[model samples]
Target chain A: MAEAFLRRHTPELFGLATLLVCVLGFEALIRGGVVNRYIIPPPSDILLAFERVIVEENILARCRDTAFEMLVAGGASVLVGVPIGVLLYRSALWRRAMEDWIGALAAAPIVLAFPLFLVLFGRSPKTIIVMGFVHGLAPIILKTVEGLASTRPVLINVGRSLKMTQSQMFWKILLPSAMPIIFTGIRLSWTFVLITIVGIEYLINLGGVGQLINELAERYDLPGTYAGICFVILVSVLFFLALERVESWLQPGR
Target chain B: MSISEKTSLAQEPALVVDDVVKRFGRGTEIVTAVDHVSFTVRQGEFVSVIGPSGCGKSTLFNIIGGLLSDYEGAVKIGEERISAPHPAVGMVFQEESTFPWRTVIDNVAFPLELQGVAKSERMDRAHHFIDMVGLASFEKAFPSQLSGGMKQRVSIARILVSQPKILLMDEPFAALDEQTRLLLGDKITQIQQELNQTTLLITHNLTEAVQLSDRIVVMTYRPGQVKRIVDINLPRPRTSDVVGSDAFGHYVAEIWNDLREEASRGMADSESAASRRATHG
Candidate 1:
């Protein structure tokens, strides 16, 4: 087991180690005046500024704003996308009719349409959050559809032979079998959420970590900006890691 | 003494398919998958369906198993007209049947759980069948962790936990190696003898059909219809050593001869389609 773990994760460990070395090297270069802090914030200054931000600012409020958006996006997409995916699967005619549209939405950049959305919804956090949801939702729907479509024919036959009701088949066979891919779509969903939230904050000035970064950068507080970036990176990594752990825990043998 | 008087859950032919027909698609492309197929599976009998691919043996199996209801005519389990999945009918399909998310124990226990059996009780019952199929050590392992034979075993164990009056197996060991096939075949025969549950297995392997079945039903190619049903007088507890025996060889020859003309006709049709596609392309 230990050997298997080492083999599976040696590259990840190498990456983390490499990142730590780069961070320390950057810090040393900045402190030694080999490079100016104007070029990039020193790690020490960034850490100190982050500590101050935590102590002074309502970091929780900003966090809550971002988190609330993510929650709303995740919950609403899971509810709406799963059924749409299943519906597309249950009928071939409906699947063919909607499939091209789903594929188009999944491929197109909903983020680029933010200006139009702002014109319609105005400059509000609700708009930012909904934009994040819209950006994140297409993949969830597509992946859920792909997952359901790709589930083994044998499992479907089992559902049929067992005389499982359509609902029972959904709850028992189709949904559970589709979960891994669907969750992967969910796992990938975070990427779009992070991008949408950060982009919106820069554009609309809603106070999230993204907005805080923008505000700090505007005031020439490079350290605060870097620190805010660090937090975003940390949260995104941790959020995905938490999701990975849950997916593995639910999947037997892992 | 009479067929009707003899019909019951415990002793009657557990599943009966009478003049059942199944067609795929419609209009000019209407393909009759199963054509007027009829069969009776006596309670505790191990009957096998043997035919070439596209012969609609699987379709017939599905009809009896109640997987497809869009077909014509009737299928009855004991005294009732079968229209839905009855828990008393357990099915073990090929290797892909086991759910990847479920452990060996949970996969086997699923039908029981759906039946509302308590978790602890279900696990206990599941473990017993798991042990019976020689998967005792891998109870907590997932389907991904198991080999193909092991996965099929888990499927078998799962089906048995329900103690269904009949077990419908669709080429359950076709994916496994020859050795595993022999072993699993013996295990299935043993289980049937012990439980005395009616069983109908559908397969194309003539040797496998010969070894595992007391009677074999052969079908023609597409627009498949039952060609002949041959009974084997071989004694029980069949092993791999029995494969080359005179009785086994005789059964194999009989089935091969019956299928030869259908096989040739199927090939001719296939060549014609290929020629058409070549011309069209």
Candidate 2:
């Protein structure tokens, strides 16, 4: 029974053990003065700093603010992106005219447009949300178009054989068939949205864990700075987990 | 009138495919797929159209099932001429067609749902057909969970639930193994006999065609044209058990001889086309 348990969890056990060794090794290096403690604090110091930062810097509020911005930006992107995708799929002329432009938009440095957004929406969370929304929109639209376009011809023929109307075909067959790909687009969209939101927060020092990290870095509090960055990593992990849950819920078969 | 007279009157033609000519491309690049093919399926009859690959059997099927509209053909079910999908015709496709997102019962009930049948009524009918296809307990199972043969059975049940006047199958069992094909063929035969259904099957497998069909329409190679229609004089209510009989072997041999010539001609045509491309290149 013990052997079976170890066999089932070998990768996880090995990964955790490796992580512990690395942390202990780094701590010893810092204590032995081989590495500069001023620049790279020991893992123990970073862990100790977590409690201080969480209590004093109001880390939970920062996390909540970042999560809220992510939620709003992600939701808006999906609401606007999916319909645009369906539109592009339905209209070949529109798709031919706009598809290249959308591709260009996806490749462009969308974060650089933060100043324009600040001028338009002002120095607030609104600016950050809008930037994230713009950054995330293109992938959702493109993936939606691709997903709908890639539905198998045989499946369409099945719908045609049943004498399904155009609207019925879109609703019953095309949309459901395109869903897995569309979910891929949504996951990608969320990643971009999260990066944009946190980056904008750090850049302007307005809200969220990005602002907290900027403040700690300026104060030269190495342990606190690293702790703030850890919170950012935590936020990303949380969003990823949430997205996976929703995806599985939506597509139980997969 | 007596019961015999009424039974004779009921044996009228259910489906007619007259002079179907489907051509692809335009002008200099023109290629004809199906060429003026004609056949009729009577009520309560099983007909198979057999041929080599690329013989436009699929094109003919698409036209009959109303998937392809740019064909010069008249496909009639009962008194109505069909250029588009008709309510009286149901088609079973060759590929994996059971919608991955739906359970077996839901997939089977899709047509009835489209026709605005009540949920309870459609579910009951779907259950009946699912049971008929030997997938009774698997009604709640998704397409992803089933094997290839089981998925095909789900599709079969889906088509059967609609209860159309005629069932048009396009190489439906061509993807299965020999044993699964024979077993499914037997199940299909049983269903047809039980329902007294009119069916038109498009296949390249001579054994499958001979096993399931009351009459076989053999077609030539590309630019597919009907070469002959051989009547199967085998007894009714037949199953795969008759496959070992001498008559079944003779029928298979006869169809194989007819198909062997066309298959070779098809191979030759492809070979020459390849050589022509290689020379030009």
Give me the candidate number with maximum lDDT: 2
Misplaced by over 4 Å in model 2 are: A1-35
DockQ measured for candidate 1:
0.52
DockQ of 2: 0.77
RMSD for each of the candidates:
3.9, 2.0
Worst 10 residues of 1 chain B by lDDT: B4-13
Error of 1 at A165 (Å): 2.5
Separately for all candidates shown, the number of backbone clashes (residues 3 or more apart, or on different chains) is 0, 0
lDDT assessment of candidate 2: 0.92
Candidate 2, residues A1-254: lDDT per residue as tens digits? Answer: 99999999999999999999999999999999999999899989999999988999999899999999999999999999999999999999999999999989888888888889999999999999999999899999999999999999999999988888999999999999999999999988998999999999999998999999899999999999998888988998898898889877777676
Q: Flag regions of model 1 displaced more than 4 Å.
A: A1-9, A20-65, A83-124, B1-12, B25-28
lDDT of 1 at B217: 90
Interface RMSD of each: 2.0, 1.0
